[model samples]
Target chain A: MRTVTRLYLSNDTSARAAGAGVLADAWSEHPEVQLIRISSRGAFYLEPMVERDSPAGRVAWFNVTAQDLPLILSGTDGTPVRSIPFLAQQTRVTFANFGETEPLALDEYQARGGLSGLETALRIGPDAIIEELQVSQLRGRGGAAFPVWNKWKVAQQARADQKYVVANADEGDAGTYCDRMILEGDPFRLLEGMLICARAIGAGRGYVYCRQEYPGAAKTLRAAIQKADEAELLELDGEPFPIEVVEGAGSYVCGEETALLESLEGKRGVVRARPPYPAQSGLYGSPTIVSNVLTFATIPNILSRGGAWHAALGTERSRGTMALQLGGRVKHPGLVEVPFGLSLHQILEQFGGGMAPGSRFKAVQVGGPLGSLFPASQMDIPVCYDVFAKAGAVLGHGGIVVYDHETDMVDLARHFMAFTADESCGKCTPCRIGSVRGREILERIQAGSGTIEDLALLHDLGDTMKVASLCALGGRAPYPVLTAIEHFPAEFRAKLRT
Target chain B: MREQVKSVLARVRSKPPNILKALLALQERLGHVPTEAVSEIASALGVTTAQVAGVLSYYPDVRLTAPGRHLIRVCMGESCYANGCGRLLRELQDRLRVDVGETAAGGKFTLDTMSCAGNCAVSPTVMIDRDLYGRLLPSQLDTLLERYK
Candidate 1:
């Protein structure tokens, strides 16, 4: 048999955006080499990183370009992928299969301990599975931090002929791609998680409401579902538990569970008031278990390892590992999944490799665009739900975006207000109109035409939005703006007219 | 245009019609959902035209008018914004002679902005059609646009 070298390249959006496709195209010229496109390891700084399966192990070359193809092909210069500090440092639970297997390969997924959770769930009954989830103390990773078992149990008990398991892959948060990473890279894990949910909740069907911007992730997920169907992995009680991928129409508010349910039902993405939550009435007036991609992706592990085992990892309230996406002015922007309670300073310095050269870190925005801005002084706060909540900040979606000295807080505040105004579903008055009013005030401040009264007015508007808004989109929309004005008041003051 | 819209709707139409899916399919096939598609889709799906139009207008991705040959979407996500995407947007507007949400003079390109594509690790990202380019700078606009044109 002629020996063929296996070359691994990341098919991740960020990796491809960083020119992985160019490298893959260049390497494909040689027929002797087998090109295996794997999911990104989340060490985005090293992309378009390539790995060559050497005699010893997989050796990675950082930032490989077409020009460096000669050395990569010759197998001369590369470091062992495991030894890379970025990949080796953290605990990877949900993203364990990342960069390890081809996204759509069922055999590859199975060989690497996939479907073990479903097996465990099959062995144990639904009540026992819920008990396991409760014992594990697994909270939803979708920013709300709701207990996962609570939702599952409600769906389990609800009397409905049709129930739904929805994975909110509508990761519209800026600086966050962990959900995208899971959907694109380890999609089977998500499927396996969904299967476990189906078994627990008696859901007949599942839908992954993927965002329109992430066409690549959606494509990968659909392919993975097809493979699962072909392998009979999606069957329950002799009927296939059909899983569909629904693409969002660029509505950020749809990430909210009720809105997501509304959107999934083929309606305008609008926020539905929640006396009877999705767990009670959702998806055409049926019981629905709506969780984000990361939350669903975390289920398989909680099942396979036992809930108590997961419960032992993190802090009192927040258990297991949190997938933190570090981006912006950080030197090494990527995904870091570790147990809860690591300080922001530690995460930024260690996993993020500190601030990028020539830039001094001014503030860091944790969670999505809706998250609060924390100054460098507050970086010592532990990365846990309770502590962040106490500080009036959110660990929403675990997106940490660092801002350098060059960033004007006023402009940023304006940007977020504008973002909220633009993305408001127009169902709520406070979010729809208040956001526009907030943006105008910020713009006036930025143009040096605002007074102290405007600042007071902003605070008043933010308070009303926080209290009266229908959903988190309106409620949390005030967080970034309020936090900005609170932490960097001088920046806003400086923008005042002379 | 009516026939094209009807054909696109016919292909995606199901028992319980997925209006969003059908509209998306129509947009995918026709580049934009023509005003004529609203009633056709509503009638096909047993929905009101207002419902169809409401959904069509709600999503930024589903457009009302035809776009240029190529679509250019600059990510306005926080990370991209932090990395000076505003300057890049201005540069694109100046160079293309078209503002955001407008097509160029000769219909060569349509400029738009996305909330975020989740490619924030490499900030200042731009998507020309389906291809996403990251770590973009204002100075590189000329070179980047040259390829699309």
Candidate 2:
């Protein structure tokens, strides 16, 4: 049989929304052409990135449109497009398989060192696997930044009839897409990561708690699960451990671990008090380890290449790489997997190519709506978990949303409060009421009715909410408001009543 | 609606946790989880109608009433907002003669806002029914909405 090389275009959210599906349909009629549907290249700016599997390597084209099809199909489109310099400089240990192999294509994945981590783990056994993770110095990418090994060791030691592992795919953060990129582009890696975690903890079942807003990700995951099942990749030494995906019902609070479990069990996604943490008793009263998708995604790389190799990359405390999702007013806006020590200036100027042409750099929001806001002067801060905390900012989920000069900080602060108020599960009085009050205060300031006394009240209310709120939704909800007032005091002052 | 709910309920075990799965299945088949369907789901899952209704209402996706012929969900996330989605949303509402959370008169369209559609690269994204339009401008909305009408 003569092999006809395949031309790939990812079926990711960015591509699909841009009418890549229509192009795929149009190209399907040609027998001479093989259009393989793979995942995104992570740098969404280059999508509908068209790649052809050639004798030399995968030839690539950028921003491919319907009109370019004839030129490409005719073999006139030359060599696979060279690696983008932005992507070339990336550390890329975790996102190694993205845009390189067919998603769920076991042969393609296996050829490119896909399941080597799992193989290493199976050979070394569970104790060694846990030790390797500890050596890696990896932390949760799901905003909390808790050490990954701590969670795994606790789950390993806690004697329960059944142990469960969950991947938090509930990426409710506004400007983040790394979780969706991994799930849609390289789903098998995510599954492999989960498998490695389950093996280390002696767990029988796992689930990916994904947000329902992402119908594309959900569909891709279902397809990938079938592919994994067919290959028997999830089975460890004849003990079958199945991984299931549970869709979140459009609640931002559910992104929190406890609320996630509540939603999984068919509840209203309310926050539960700690001490009996999910690590201790979770998911039907069984011991569970709930981790973010990136936390698990990093596991395969750590196990494949020794934990020391992973640990050697980043700062002493925050090891390995971080998948930075650049959004808002940036030129090269997309996902970048870089080492953890890069400064905000390097990320914005070098990787992101600074703010999009006309938009003057004003402020950047790190993390989600609940995350702190940074002024242009604060761009020297290195992107490390501990460093970020010390500097009064957080590297939550590595989502960097840039704002131009025209943007009103007062409006942005109000928007954050509004988002929190709308999404609050009403689990605690402080969060439920505090967020609404904060929104009203910001609104009053915006309407030119707020006094300087109102600023003091806002700060006091923020402090109360920070201490009294149930989970992060309320606890961190004041971050943007307080930071906005602190950093962009002029914006609030200009709006105050004379 | 009861028969439809009963059929979906029959597929899964009559357990407490299956309420979400059951409601989702019902929502997929029927646009919304109707009052009758909620009662049937509650009875099948061994929970009360209020419990089932509470679960449905809690989720932004699962609605009580059926959506209009076309669902226009604008991405209101940070990226989209930065790229002038607020203007696009306002223009869409004005053209449709409806608010953000209401369905248009004569049952043609339902205007709503979503968190993040994961289409950050192409900001100001709008999904009309199953088709998503990205990098949307207020001027282009009329032409885009024309297809659905």
* DockQ comparisons of all candidates to the true complex: 0.84, 0.70
The lDDT leader among the candidates is 1
Residue lDDT tens for model 1, B1-149: 78888788778878667788988898888888888667778998998998888888888888989999999999999889888898989998898888899999999999999999899998889998888999987888888889875
Superposed model 1: Cα runs more than 4 Å off: A1-3
Model 2 Cα displacement at A195 (Å)?
1.2
Local distance difference test values of all predictions, in order: 0.90, 0.84
**Clashing residue pairs, backbone N/CA/C < 3 A, model 2:** A59-A80, A60-A80, A60-A81
lDDT by residue for model 1 (A242-334), tens: 999989888999899988888888888899998798889988899999998999889888898899999999899889999999888999999
Cα deviation of A319 in candidate 2 (Å)? 0.3
lDDT of 1 at B50: 89
User: Model 2 off-target regions past 4 Å?
Assistant: A1-6, A53-56, A73-80
Give chain B TM-scores in order. Answer: 0.95, 0.91
Q: What's the TM-score of every candidate structure?
A: 0.98, 0.96
